[model samples]
Target chain A: MSAAATPPASSEESTDASSPATGRIPGNRAIWVGILAELTEFTLMFLVYFFARVNHPQMFHEGPRRLSLLAGSANTLIMVSSSYLVARAVLAMRQDRPEGALRWLLAAFVVGAGYPVVKFLEVRWNLEQGLTGGGDVFQMSYYYLTFNHLVHTGWGLLGMAWVVVRTWMGAYDAKNHNGLVAFASYWHATDLVWLMIFPLFYVMP
Target chain B: MTALRKIDLAWALLVLFTLTGVFLGEFRQGGFWVVLVIALVTALKGRLVIDVFMELGEASPVLRRLVRGFGLLVPALILVTYLWGPLLARFNWLLE
Candidate 1:
Protein backbone atom coordinates (compact mmCIF):
# COMPACT_ATOMS: atom_id res chain seq x y z
CA MET A 1 0.00 0.00 0.00
CA SER A 2 3.01 2.27 0.31
CA ALA A 3 4.11 4.33 -2.68
CA ALA A 4 7.20 2.19 -2.96
CA ALA A 5 5.17 -1.00 -2.72
CA THR A 6 3.06 0.26 -5.54
CA PRO A 7 5.02 0.63 -8.77
CA PRO A 8 7.73 3.19 -7.98
CA ALA A 9 7.94 4.40 -11.54
CA SER A 10 6.76 7.21 -13.71
CA SER A 11 3.13 7.02 -14.81
CA GLU A 12 4.21 5.88 -18.23
CA GLU A 13 6.29 2.99 -16.95
CA SER A 14 3.64 1.86 -14.51
CA THR A 15 1.03 2.03 -17.20
CA ASP A 16 3.18 -0.16 -19.41
CA ALA A 17 3.89 -2.63 -16.61
CA SER A 18 0.23 -3.09 -15.79
CA SER A 19 -1.92 -5.96 -17.01
CA PRO A 20 -4.34 -5.46 -19.90
CA ALA A 21 -2.18 -2.55 -20.94
CA THR A 22 -3.77 0.31 -22.79
CA GLY A 23 -0.44 1.67 -23.96
CA ARG A 24 0.96 4.71 -22.15
CA ILE A 25 -1.53 6.74 -20.21
CA PRO A 26 -2.30 9.54 -22.63
CA GLY A 27 -0.25 12.57 -21.76
CA ASN A 28 -1.78 15.65 -20.21
CA ARG A 29 -1.01 17.48 -23.44
CA ALA A 30 -3.23 15.33 -25.60
CA ILE A 31 -6.13 15.65 -23.21
CA TRP A 32 -5.72 19.40 -22.98
CA VAL A 33 -5.57 19.69 -26.75
CA GLY A 34 -8.80 17.77 -27.11
CA ILE A 35 -10.48 19.92 -24.49
CA LEU A 36 -9.25 23.10 -26.16
CA ALA A 37 -10.67 22.01 -29.47
CA GLU A 38 -14.07 21.44 -27.90
CA LEU A 39 -13.87 24.80 -26.15
CA THR A 40 -13.07 26.50 -29.41
CA GLU A 41 -16.19 25.07 -30.96
CA PHE A 42 -18.17 26.36 -28.00
CA THR A 43 -16.57 29.79 -28.21
CA LEU A 44 -17.60 30.11 -31.86
CA MET A 45 -21.14 29.29 -30.86
CA PHE A 46 -20.99 31.89 -28.12
CA LEU A 47 -19.70 34.49 -30.54
CA VAL A 48 -22.62 33.78 -32.81
CA TYR A 49 -24.92 34.39 -29.87
CA PHE A 50 -23.07 37.57 -29.01
CA PHE A 51 -23.68 38.92 -32.50
CA ALA A 52 -27.30 37.89 -32.36
CA ARG A 53 -27.80 39.50 -28.99
CA VAL A 54 -26.25 42.68 -30.29
CA ASN A 55 -28.46 42.72 -33.35
CA HIS A 56 -31.66 41.52 -31.70
CA PRO A 57 -31.79 42.01 -27.95
CA GLN A 58 -35.50 41.22 -27.72
CA MET A 59 -35.05 37.76 -29.18
CA PHE A 60 -32.56 36.79 -26.45
CA HIS A 61 -34.46 37.99 -23.40
CA GLU A 62 -37.35 35.57 -23.39
CA GLY A 63 -35.17 32.48 -23.42
CA PRO A 64 -32.79 33.88 -20.85
CA ARG A 65 -35.76 34.75 -18.65
CA ARG A 66 -37.12 31.24 -18.83
CA LEU A 67 -33.83 29.79 -17.52
CA SER A 68 -34.12 28.42 -14.01
CA LEU A 69 -31.45 29.98 -11.85
CA LEU A 70 -32.27 27.72 -8.92
CA ALA A 71 -31.53 24.56 -10.86
CA GLY A 72 -28.41 26.08 -12.36
CA SER A 73 -27.10 27.07 -8.93
CA ALA A 74 -27.80 23.65 -7.53
CA ASN A 75 -25.89 22.04 -10.39
CA THR A 76 -23.00 24.38 -9.77
CA LEU A 77 -22.81 23.33 -6.15
CA ILE A 78 -23.00 19.70 -7.17
CA MET A 79 -20.11 20.04 -9.61
CA VAL A 80 -17.96 21.95 -7.13
CA SER A 81 -18.51 19.32 -4.49
CA SER A 82 -17.80 16.57 -7.00
CA SER A 83 -14.50 18.17 -7.93
CA TYR A 84 -13.60 18.44 -4.27
CA LEU A 85 -14.42 14.80 -3.74
CA VAL A 86 -12.26 13.78 -6.69
CA ALA A 87 -9.38 15.75 -5.21
CA ARG A 88 -9.85 14.00 -1.91
CA ALA A 89 -9.94 10.70 -3.72
CA VAL A 90 -6.59 11.38 -5.34
CA LEU A 91 -5.15 12.32 -1.97
CA ALA A 92 -6.49 9.11 -0.51
CA MET A 93 -4.96 7.12 -3.34
CA ARG A 94 -1.63 8.82 -2.68
CA GLN A 95 -1.92 7.82 0.94
CA ASP A 96 -2.47 4.20 -0.22
CA ARG A 97 -5.99 4.27 1.15
CA PRO A 98 -7.77 2.47 -1.67
CA GLU A 99 -11.06 1.97 0.13
CA GLY A 100 -11.28 5.65 1.04
CA ALA A 101 -10.49 6.67 -2.50
CA LEU A 102 -13.07 4.29 -3.87
CA ARG A 103 -15.72 5.71 -1.58
CA TRP A 104 -14.90 9.23 -2.61
CA LEU A 105 -14.96 8.23 -6.29
CA LEU A 106 -18.41 6.78 -5.80
CA ALA A 107 -19.56 9.96 -4.12
CA ALA A 108 -18.13 12.03 -6.93
CA PHE A 109 -19.91 9.85 -9.46
CA VAL A 110 -23.22 10.36 -7.67
CA VAL A 111 -22.84 14.13 -7.61
CA GLY A 112 -21.77 14.16 -11.24
CA ALA A 113 -24.84 12.16 -12.16
CA GLY A 114 -27.07 14.64 -10.39
CA TYR A 115 -25.95 17.46 -12.67
CA PRO A 116 -27.53 16.06 -15.82
CA VAL A 117 -30.74 15.17 -14.04
CA VAL A 118 -31.14 18.78 -12.98
CA LYS A 119 -30.23 19.90 -16.47
CA PHE A 120 -32.84 17.59 -17.99
CA LEU A 121 -35.53 19.06 -15.78
CA GLU A 122 -34.43 22.59 -16.65
CA VAL A 123 -34.43 21.84 -20.37
CA ARG A 124 -37.87 20.27 -20.12
CA TRP A 125 -39.19 23.30 -18.30
CA ASN A 126 -37.73 25.61 -20.94
CA LEU A 127 -39.38 23.60 -23.68
CA GLU A 128 -42.69 23.80 -21.85
CA GLN A 129 -42.22 27.57 -21.75
CA GLY A 130 -41.90 27.71 -25.53
CA LEU A 131 -38.16 28.18 -25.74
CA THR A 132 -37.18 25.68 -28.37
CA GLY A 133 -33.75 25.91 -29.97
CA GLY A 134 -35.35 26.94 -33.25
CA GLY A 135 -37.24 29.85 -31.67
CA ASP A 136 -34.39 32.38 -31.56
CA VAL A 137 -30.69 32.91 -31.20
CA PHE A 138 -30.82 32.96 -27.39
CA GLN A 139 -32.67 29.68 -27.16
CA MET A 140 -30.18 28.12 -29.52
CA SER A 141 -27.22 29.41 -27.53
CA TYR A 142 -28.82 28.28 -24.31
CA TYR A 143 -29.22 24.77 -25.65
CA TYR A 144 -25.83 24.81 -27.32
CA LEU A 145 -23.82 25.76 -24.26
CA THR A 146 -25.77 23.94 -21.56
CA PHE A 147 -26.29 20.75 -23.55
CA ASN A 148 -22.64 20.71 -24.59
CA HIS A 149 -21.64 20.92 -20.95
CA LEU A 150 -24.16 18.24 -20.10
CA VAL A 151 -22.60 15.92 -22.66
CA HIS A 152 -19.22 16.49 -21.07
CA THR A 153 -20.75 15.86 -17.68
CA GLY A 154 -22.18 12.59 -18.90
CA TRP A 155 -18.75 11.50 -20.08
CA GLY A 156 -17.27 12.66 -16.78
CA LEU A 157 -19.76 10.57 -14.81
CA LEU A 158 -18.88 7.53 -16.86
CA GLY A 159 -15.21 8.20 -16.29
CA MET A 160 -15.84 8.57 -12.58
CA ALA A 161 -17.75 5.32 -12.52
CA TRP A 162 -14.84 3.61 -14.27
CA VAL A 163 -12.42 5.09 -11.79
CA VAL A 164 -14.59 3.86 -8.96
CA VAL A 165 -14.65 0.36 -10.31
CA ARG A 166 -10.94 0.28 -10.95
CA THR A 167 -10.10 1.74 -7.57
CA TRP A 168 -12.29 -0.87 -5.94
CA MET A 169 -10.37 -3.50 -7.85
CA GLY A 170 -7.11 -2.01 -6.52
CA ALA A 171 -6.03 -1.11 -10.03
CA TYR A 172 -4.99 2.44 -9.20
CA ASP A 173 -1.95 2.92 -7.02
CA ALA A 174 0.16 6.03 -6.78
CA LYS A 175 2.13 5.31 -9.92
CA ASN A 176 -0.63 3.84 -12.05
CA HIS A 177 -3.38 6.32 -11.32
CA ASN A 178 -3.17 8.33 -14.52
CA GLY A 179 -6.65 7.26 -15.57
CA LEU A 180 -7.99 8.66 -12.34
CA VAL A 181 -5.92 11.79 -12.81
CA ALA A 182 -7.18 12.31 -16.36
CA PHE A 183 -10.74 11.76 -15.24
CA ALA A 184 -10.31 14.31 -12.47
CA SER A 185 -8.86 16.83 -14.90
CA TYR A 186 -11.70 16.38 -17.41
CA TRP A 187 -14.34 16.63 -14.70
CA HIS A 188 -12.83 19.83 -13.36
CA ALA A 189 -12.65 21.27 -16.87
CA THR A 190 -16.33 20.60 -17.32
CA ASP A 191 -16.99 22.40 -14.05
CA LEU A 192 -14.73 25.26 -15.12
CA VAL A 193 -16.62 25.83 -18.39
CA TRP A 194 -19.95 25.78 -16.56
CA LEU A 195 -18.62 28.31 -14.09
CA MET A 196 -18.25 30.71 -17.00
CA ILE A 197 -21.44 29.75 -18.77
CA PHE A 198 -23.79 29.88 -15.77
CA PRO A 199 -23.35 33.55 -15.01
CA LEU A 200 -22.85 34.65 -18.60
CA PHE A 201 -26.05 33.07 -19.81
CA TYR A 202 -28.14 32.85 -16.67
CA VAL A 203 -27.32 35.54 -14.15
CA MET A 204 -26.10 38.26 -16.48
CA PRO A 205 -28.04 40.51 -18.85
CA MET B 1 2.29 5.64 2.57
CA THR B 2 2.81 9.35 2.76
CA ALA B 3 1.08 11.25 5.53
CA LEU B 4 -1.82 13.30 4.20
CA ARG B 5 -1.18 17.02 4.23
CA LYS B 6 -3.85 19.02 5.98
CA ILE B 7 -6.66 19.71 3.53
CA ASP B 8 -7.11 23.36 2.58
CA LEU B 9 -10.56 23.20 4.09
CA ALA B 10 -10.67 26.89 4.98
CA TRP B 11 -10.03 28.08 1.44
CA ALA B 12 -12.64 25.70 0.12
CA LEU B 13 -15.13 27.01 2.65
CA LEU B 14 -14.35 30.56 1.65
CA VAL B 15 -15.08 29.79 -2.00
CA LEU B 16 -18.34 28.10 -1.14
CA PHE B 17 -19.43 31.03 1.00
CA THR B 18 -18.53 33.54 -1.70
CA LEU B 19 -20.45 31.57 -4.32
CA THR B 20 -23.46 31.35 -2.03
CA GLY B 21 -23.36 35.09 -1.44
CA VAL B 22 -23.21 35.73 -5.17
CA PHE B 23 -26.15 33.45 -5.79
CA LEU B 24 -28.28 35.18 -3.18
CA GLY B 25 -27.19 38.64 -4.25
CA GLU B 26 -28.26 37.93 -7.83
CA PHE B 27 -31.90 37.99 -6.71
CA ARG B 28 -31.67 41.64 -5.69
CA GLN B 29 -30.80 44.84 -7.61
CA GLY B 30 -27.37 45.58 -9.10
CA GLY B 31 -27.62 42.75 -11.61
CA PHE B 32 -24.58 43.73 -13.67
CA TRP B 33 -22.28 44.08 -10.70
CA VAL B 34 -23.59 40.82 -9.28
CA VAL B 35 -22.85 39.02 -12.53
CA LEU B 36 -19.40 40.57 -12.75
CA VAL B 37 -18.55 39.55 -9.21
CA ILE B 38 -19.89 36.07 -9.75
CA ALA B 39 -17.79 35.61 -12.91
CA LEU B 40 -14.68 36.76 -11.10
CA VAL B 41 -15.37 34.46 -8.17
CA THR B 42 -16.02 31.56 -10.50
CA ALA B 43 -12.68 32.11 -12.23
CA LEU B 44 -10.94 32.10 -8.87
CA LYS B 45 -12.74 28.93 -7.93
CA GLY B 46 -11.66 27.34 -11.21
CA ARG B 47 -8.06 28.22 -10.44
CA LEU B 48 -8.34 26.76 -6.98
CA VAL B 49 -9.79 23.58 -8.35
CA ILE B 50 -6.99 23.34 -10.88
CA ASP B 51 -4.09 24.20 -8.60
CA VAL B 52 -5.09 22.61 -5.31
CA PHE B 53 -7.67 20.02 -6.18
CA MET B 54 -6.13 18.74 -9.39
CA GLU B 55 -2.63 19.12 -7.98
CA LEU B 56 -1.56 21.05 -11.03
CA GLY B 57 1.08 22.63 -8.83
CA GLU B 58 2.70 19.24 -8.31
CA ALA B 59 2.60 18.26 -11.96
CA SER B 60 5.61 18.12 -14.24
CA PRO B 61 6.90 21.38 -15.66
CA VAL B 62 5.93 20.42 -19.21
CA LEU B 63 2.39 19.72 -18.13
CA ARG B 64 2.25 22.99 -16.24
CA ARG B 65 3.47 24.85 -19.30
CA LEU B 66 0.79 23.26 -21.43
CA VAL B 67 -1.88 24.42 -19.01
CA ARG B 68 -0.39 27.91 -18.82
CA GLY B 69 -0.28 28.22 -22.58
CA PHE B 70 -3.85 27.11 -23.02
CA GLY B 71 -4.98 29.41 -20.23
CA LEU B 72 -3.35 32.41 -21.85
CA LEU B 73 -4.34 31.63 -25.40
CA VAL B 74 -7.99 30.84 -24.79
CA PRO B 75 -8.77 34.06 -22.92
CA ALA B 76 -6.74 36.11 -25.35
CA LEU B 77 -8.76 34.80 -28.24
CA ILE B 78 -12.00 35.50 -26.44
CA LEU B 79 -10.95 39.04 -25.61
CA VAL B 80 -9.82 39.65 -29.17
CA THR B 81 -13.20 38.67 -30.46
CA TYR B 82 -14.92 40.80 -27.88
CA LEU B 83 -12.83 43.87 -28.64
CA TRP B 84 -11.49 43.97 -32.20
CA GLY B 85 -14.17 42.00 -33.93
CA PRO B 86 -16.93 43.95 -32.28
CA LEU B 87 -15.19 47.24 -33.05
CA LEU B 88 -14.80 46.31 -36.67
CA ALA B 89 -18.47 45.46 -36.85
CA ARG B 90 -19.39 48.75 -35.17
CA PHE B 91 -17.36 50.67 -37.75
CA ASN B 92 -18.93 48.69 -40.56
CA TRP B 93 -15.51 47.64 -41.77
CA LEU B 94 -16.68 44.20 -42.80
CA LEU B 95 -19.33 45.67 -45.05
CA GLU B 96 -16.81 47.57 -47.13
Candidate 2:
Protein backbone atom coordinates (compact mmCIF):
# COMPACT_ATOMS: atom_id res chain seq x y z
CA MET A 1 0.00 0.00 0.00
CA SER A 2 1.12 3.58 -0.64
CA ALA A 3 2.22 5.72 2.31
CA ALA A 4 -0.48 8.19 1.36
CA ALA A 5 -3.13 5.53 1.89
CA THR A 6 -2.04 4.18 5.24
CA PRO A 7 -3.38 5.56 8.52
CA PRO A 8 -0.88 7.98 10.01
CA ALA A 9 0.75 6.75 13.22
CA SER A 10 1.52 10.43 13.90
CA SER A 11 -2.16 11.18 14.10
CA GLU A 12 -2.44 8.45 16.70
CA GLU A 13 0.19 10.10 18.92
CA SER A 14 -1.53 13.48 18.88
CA THR A 15 -5.03 12.12 19.33
CA ASP A 16 -4.41 9.82 22.28
CA ALA A 17 -5.38 12.22 25.08
CA SER A 18 -5.89 9.72 27.86
CA SER A 19 -3.82 6.57 28.33
CA PRO A 20 -2.13 4.89 25.37
CA ALA A 21 -5.13 2.76 24.44
CA THR A 22 -7.68 4.62 26.55
CA GLY A 23 -10.08 5.35 23.70
CA ARG A 24 -8.49 3.61 20.75
CA ILE A 25 -10.12 1.34 18.24
CA PRO A 26 -7.15 -1.02 18.40
CA GLY A 27 -6.29 -0.21 14.78
CA ASN A 28 -7.41 2.23 12.11
CA ARG A 29 -11.12 2.60 11.60
CA ALA A 30 -10.67 2.31 7.84
CA ILE A 31 -9.13 -1.11 8.23
CA TRP A 32 -11.94 -2.20 10.48
CA VAL A 33 -14.39 -1.20 7.79
CA GLY A 34 -12.56 -3.39 5.34
CA ILE A 35 -12.43 -6.23 7.85
CA LEU A 36 -16.15 -5.99 8.39
CA ALA A 37 -16.76 -6.20 4.64
CA GLU A 38 -14.47 -9.18 4.26
CA LEU A 39 -16.05 -11.03 7.16
CA THR A 40 -19.52 -10.47 5.72
CA GLU A 41 -18.35 -11.85 2.38
CA PHE A 42 -16.97 -14.96 4.02
CA THR A 43 -20.13 -15.46 6.05
CA LEU A 44 -22.18 -15.59 2.88
CA MET A 45 -19.72 -17.96 1.26
CA PHE A 46 -19.94 -20.21 4.30
CA LEU A 47 -23.68 -20.31 3.94
CA VAL A 48 -23.15 -21.41 0.36
CA TYR A 49 -20.92 -24.16 1.68
CA PHE A 50 -23.59 -25.40 4.06
CA PHE A 51 -26.22 -25.17 1.35
CA ALA A 52 -24.20 -27.45 -0.87
CA ARG A 53 -23.54 -29.80 2.01
CA VAL A 54 -27.18 -29.96 2.88
CA ASN A 55 -28.04 -30.89 -0.69
CA HIS A 56 -25.21 -33.41 -0.86
CA PRO A 57 -24.46 -34.94 2.50
CA GLN A 58 -22.66 -37.92 1.02
CA MET A 59 -20.27 -35.72 -0.93
CA PHE A 60 -19.65 -33.63 2.18
CA HIS A 61 -18.96 -36.76 4.21
CA GLU A 62 -16.59 -38.29 1.66
CA GLY A 63 -14.98 -35.08 0.46
CA PRO A 64 -12.71 -34.43 3.46
CA ARG A 65 -11.23 -37.92 3.34
CA ARG A 66 -10.10 -37.34 -0.23
CA LEU A 67 -8.02 -34.28 0.67
CA SER A 68 -4.43 -34.76 1.79
CA LEU A 69 -4.48 -34.70 5.56
CA LEU A 70 -0.81 -33.82 5.50
CA ALA A 71 -1.35 -30.81 3.27
CA GLY A 72 -4.30 -29.41 5.20
CA SER A 73 -2.47 -30.07 8.44
CA ALA A 74 0.64 -28.27 7.21
CA ASN A 75 -1.32 -25.21 6.15
CA THR A 76 -3.13 -25.10 9.48
CA LEU A 77 0.12 -25.10 11.46
CA ILE A 78 1.66 -22.43 9.26
CA MET A 79 -1.34 -20.09 9.54
CA VAL A 80 -1.55 -20.39 13.31
CA SER A 81 2.22 -19.93 13.69
CA SER A 82 2.19 -16.89 11.50
CA SER A 83 -0.59 -15.37 13.57
CA TYR A 84 1.27 -16.13 16.80
CA LEU A 85 4.50 -14.54 15.60
CA VAL A 86 2.74 -11.38 14.48
CA ALA A 87 0.88 -11.08 17.75
CA ARG A 88 4.25 -11.24 19.43
CA ALA A 89 5.49 -8.62 17.03
CA VAL A 90 2.77 -6.26 18.19
CA LEU A 91 3.55 -7.00 21.80
CA ALA A 92 7.25 -6.45 21.17
CA MET A 93 6.72 -3.10 19.51
CA ARG A 94 4.46 -1.99 22.34
CA GLN A 95 7.17 -2.78 24.88
CA ASP A 96 9.64 -0.50 22.98
CA ARG A 97 11.55 -3.52 21.68
CA PRO A 98 11.83 -2.57 18.02
CA GLU A 99 14.56 -5.09 17.33
CA GLY A 100 12.50 -7.81 18.94
CA ALA A 101 9.41 -6.64 17.11
CA LEU A 102 11.25 -6.53 13.78
CA ARG A 103 12.67 -9.96 14.42
CA TRP A 104 9.27 -11.41 15.15
CA LEU A 105 7.71 -9.58 12.20
CA LEU A 106 10.39 -10.94 9.87
CA ALA A 107 9.76 -14.36 11.27
CA ALA A 108 6.03 -13.90 10.74
CA PHE A 109 6.46 -12.71 7.16
CA VAL A 110 8.63 -15.75 6.45
CA VAL A 111 6.10 -18.17 7.94
CA GLY A 112 3.22 -16.38 6.26
CA ALA A 113 4.98 -16.63 2.91
CA GLY A 114 4.84 -20.38 3.32
CA TYR A 115 1.04 -20.45 3.02
CA PRO A 116 0.95 -19.79 -0.71
CA VAL A 117 3.81 -22.16 -1.46
CA VAL A 118 2.04 -24.94 0.38
CA LYS A 119 -1.22 -24.08 -1.36
CA PHE A 120 0.48 -24.27 -4.76
CA LEU A 121 1.79 -27.70 -3.94
CA GLU A 122 -1.55 -28.71 -2.51
CA VAL A 123 -3.25 -27.60 -5.72
CA ARG A 124 -0.80 -29.69 -7.69
CA TRP A 125 -1.44 -32.63 -5.42
CA ASN A 126 -5.13 -32.22 -5.84
CA LEU A 127 -4.72 -32.15 -9.61
CA GLU A 128 -2.50 -35.24 -9.53
CA GLN A 129 -5.24 -36.95 -7.56
CA GLY A 130 -7.76 -36.03 -10.28
CA LEU A 131 -9.47 -33.53 -8.04
CA THR A 132 -10.48 -30.32 -9.74
CA GLY A 133 -12.95 -27.57 -9.01
CA GLY A 134 -15.42 -29.23 -11.34
CA GLY A 135 -14.97 -32.63 -9.70
CA ASP A 136 -18.15 -32.51 -7.62
CA VAL A 137 -20.24 -30.16 -5.54
CA PHE A 138 -17.98 -30.45 -2.52
CA GLN A 139 -14.85 -30.05 -4.60
CA MET A 140 -16.28 -27.06 -6.39
CA SER A 141 -17.08 -25.22 -3.16
CA TYR A 142 -13.74 -26.28 -1.75
CA TYR A 143 -11.77 -24.82 -4.63
CA TYR A 144 -13.60 -21.51 -4.75
CA LEU A 145 -13.61 -20.95 -0.99
CA THR A 146 -9.97 -21.89 -0.45
CA PHE A 147 -8.78 -20.09 -3.56
CA ASN A 148 -10.54 -16.91 -2.51
CA HIS A 149 -8.79 -17.24 0.83
CA LEU A 150 -5.48 -17.65 -0.96
CA VAL A 151 -6.10 -14.39 -2.78
CA HIS A 152 -6.86 -12.67 0.53
CA THR A 153 -3.67 -14.12 1.96
CA GLY A 154 -1.83 -12.64 -0.99
CA TRP A 155 -3.20 -9.24 -0.03
CA GLY A 156 -1.98 -9.80 3.51
CA LEU A 157 1.51 -10.74 2.31
CA LEU A 158 1.64 -7.58 0.27
CA GLY A 159 0.57 -5.54 3.27
CA MET A 160 3.19 -7.24 5.44
CA ALA A 161 5.86 -6.31 2.93
CA TRP A 162 4.93 -2.66 3.31
CA VAL A 163 4.98 -2.98 7.10
CA VAL A 164 8.46 -4.49 6.82
CA VAL A 165 9.71 -1.47 4.91
CA ARG A 166 8.16 0.94 7.40
CA THR A 167 9.51 -0.95 10.37
CA TRP A 168 12.92 -1.03 8.73
CA MET A 169 12.77 2.76 8.42
CA GLY A 170 12.06 2.89 12.17
CA ALA A 171 8.67 4.42 11.51
CA TYR A 172 6.86 2.39 14.16
CA ASP A 173 7.75 2.81 17.83
CA ALA A 174 6.14 1.89 21.15
CA LYS A 175 3.95 4.99 21.22
CA ASN A 176 2.95 4.98 17.55
CA HIS A 177 2.32 1.80 15.57
CA ASN A 178 -1.14 2.34 14.19
CA GLY A 179 -0.09 1.26 10.73
CA LEU A 180 1.59 -1.79 12.14
CA VAL A 181 -1.44 -2.57 14.25
CA ALA A 182 -3.70 -2.16 11.23
CA PHE A 183 -1.56 -4.51 9.19
CA ALA A 184 -1.57 -7.04 12.00
CA SER A 185 -5.31 -6.71 12.31
CA TYR A 186 -5.72 -7.44 8.62
CA TRP A 187 -3.44 -10.46 8.71
CA HIS A 188 -5.07 -11.84 11.87
CA ALA A 189 -8.49 -11.46 10.31
CA THR A 190 -7.24 -13.42 7.35
CA ASP A 191 -5.93 -16.01 9.78
CA LEU A 192 -9.33 -16.20 11.42
CA VAL A 193 -10.95 -16.89 8.07
CA TRP A 194 -8.53 -19.74 7.40
CA LEU A 195 -9.21 -21.17 10.83
CA MET A 196 -12.89 -21.39 9.98
CA ILE A 197 -12.20 -22.55 6.44
CA PHE A 198 -10.02 -25.41 7.65
CA PRO A 199 -12.72 -26.86 9.85
CA LEU A 200 -15.60 -26.36 7.47
CA PHE A 201 -13.82 -27.89 4.48
CA TYR A 202 -11.20 -30.17 5.96
CA VAL A 203 -12.16 -31.26 9.45
CA MET A 204 -15.91 -31.78 9.80
CA PRO A 205 -15.94 -35.33 8.64
CA MET B 1 2.26 -14.67 34.25
CA THR B 2 3.42 -11.90 31.96
CA ALA B 3 1.33 -10.76 28.98
CA LEU B 4 4.05 -11.81 26.54
CA ARG B 5 4.16 -15.23 28.10
CA LYS B 6 0.41 -15.29 27.99
CA ILE B 7 0.47 -14.63 24.25
CA ASP B 8 2.88 -17.50 23.84
CA LEU B 9 0.59 -19.68 25.88
CA ALA B 10 -2.35 -18.75 23.69
CA TRP B 11 -0.31 -19.61 20.62
CA ALA B 12 0.65 -22.97 22.12
CA LEU B 13 -2.95 -23.73 22.92
CA LEU B 14 -4.05 -22.73 19.41
CA VAL B 15 -1.51 -25.09 17.86
CA LEU B 16 -2.54 -27.88 20.21
CA PHE B 17 -6.23 -27.44 19.46
CA THR B 18 -5.51 -27.38 15.71
CA LEU B 19 -3.58 -30.63 15.88
CA THR B 20 -6.39 -32.19 17.85
CA GLY B 21 -8.92 -31.08 15.25
CA VAL B 22 -6.79 -32.55 12.47
CA PHE B 23 -6.38 -35.79 14.39
CA LEU B 24 -10.09 -36.09 14.72
CA GLY B 25 -10.45 -35.25 11.06
CA GLU B 26 -8.06 -38.01 10.05
CA PHE B 27 -8.50 -40.94 12.39
CA ARG B 28 -11.80 -40.59 14.11
CA GLN B 29 -14.52 -43.25 13.67
CA GLY B 30 -16.79 -40.50 12.26
CA GLY B 31 -20.00 -39.73 14.13
CA PHE B 32 -22.17 -36.87 15.38
CA TRP B 33 -20.13 -36.35 18.51
CA VAL B 34 -16.92 -36.18 16.49
CA VAL B 35 -18.23 -33.32 14.39
CA LEU B 36 -19.54 -31.53 17.45
CA VAL B 37 -16.21 -31.76 19.19
CA ILE B 38 -14.43 -30.32 16.16
CA ALA B 39 -16.90 -27.44 15.96
CA LEU B 40 -16.44 -26.61 19.63
CA VAL B 41 -12.68 -26.59 19.28
CA THR B 42 -12.93 -24.38 16.21
CA ALA B 43 -15.04 -21.93 18.18
CA LEU B 44 -12.50 -21.86 21.01
CA LYS B 45 -9.58 -21.22 18.63
CA GLY B 46 -11.46 -18.42 16.91
CA ARG B 47 -12.37 -16.76 20.22
CA LEU B 48 -8.78 -16.91 21.44
CA VAL B 49 -7.55 -15.08 18.36
CA ILE B 50 -10.23 -12.44 18.70
CA ASP B 51 -9.75 -11.91 22.40
CA VAL B 52 -6.00 -12.29 22.90
CA PHE B 53 -4.33 -11.51 19.60
CA MET B 54 -6.78 -8.90 18.32
CA GLU B 55 -6.74 -7.18 21.71
CA LEU B 56 -10.50 -7.13 21.69
CA GLY B 57 -11.11 -8.54 25.17
CA GLU B 58 -10.82 -5.11 26.75
CA ALA B 59 -11.99 -3.25 23.71
CA SER B 60 -15.16 -1.20 23.57
CA PRO B 61 -18.41 -3.11 23.87
CA VAL B 62 -19.48 -2.55 20.27
CA LEU B 63 -16.15 -3.59 18.80
CA ARG B 64 -15.90 -6.58 21.09
CA ARG B 65 -19.34 -7.82 20.17
CA LEU B 66 -18.67 -7.44 16.46
CA VAL B 67 -15.45 -9.40 16.66
CA ARG B 68 -17.00 -12.07 18.80
CA GLY B 69 -19.95 -12.43 16.45
CA PHE B 70 -17.70 -12.64 13.39
CA GLY B 71 -15.64 -15.33 15.11
CA LEU B 72 -18.59 -17.52 15.98
CA LEU B 73 -20.81 -16.98 12.94
CA VAL B 74 -19.44 -19.60 10.60
CA PRO B 75 -18.77 -22.40 13.06
CA ALA B 76 -22.16 -21.92 14.68
CA LEU B 77 -23.88 -22.13 11.33
CA ILE B 78 -21.86 -25.21 10.39
CA LEU B 79 -22.85 -26.95 13.60
CA VAL B 80 -26.46 -26.09 13.06
CA THR B 81 -26.45 -27.60 9.58
CA TYR B 82 -24.38 -30.56 10.63
CA LEU B 83 -26.50 -31.61 13.57
CA TRP B 84 -29.81 -30.89 11.94
CA GLY B 85 -29.21 -31.68 8.31
CA PRO B 86 -32.55 -33.34 7.66
CA LEU B 87 -34.57 -30.74 9.48
CA LEU B 88 -32.68 -27.90 7.81
CA ALA B 89 -33.03 -29.58 4.46
CA ARG B 90 -36.76 -29.50 4.82
CA PHE B 91 -36.55 -25.70 4.79
CA ASN B 92 -34.30 -25.73 1.74
CA TRP B 93 -37.35 -25.34 -0.46
CA LEU B 94 -37.79 -21.88 0.96
CA LEU B 95 -34.58 -20.74 -0.68
CA GLU B 96 -35.65 -22.00 -4.04
lDDT per residue (tens digit) for residues B13-36 in model 1 = 635744664454456334445444
Model 1 chain A: weakest 10-residue lDDT segment is: A17-26
The true-versus-predicted C-alpha distance at residue B23 of model 1, in Å, is 3.2
Model 1 spans > 4 angstroms off: A1-29, A58-63, B1-25, B28-32, B58-96
TM-scores of all candidate predictions against the true structure: 0.75, 0.91
User: Taking the tens digit of each residue's C-alpha lDDT, what string does model 2 give over A70-138?
Assistant: 888889899889989998888888888888888999999999999999999999999999999889999
Quick one: best lDDT, which candidate? 2
Task: Please give the CA lDDT of all the candidate structures.
Answer: 0.62, 0.84
Give the docking tier of candidate 2: acceptable
Q: TM-score of the candidate numbered 2?
A: 0.91
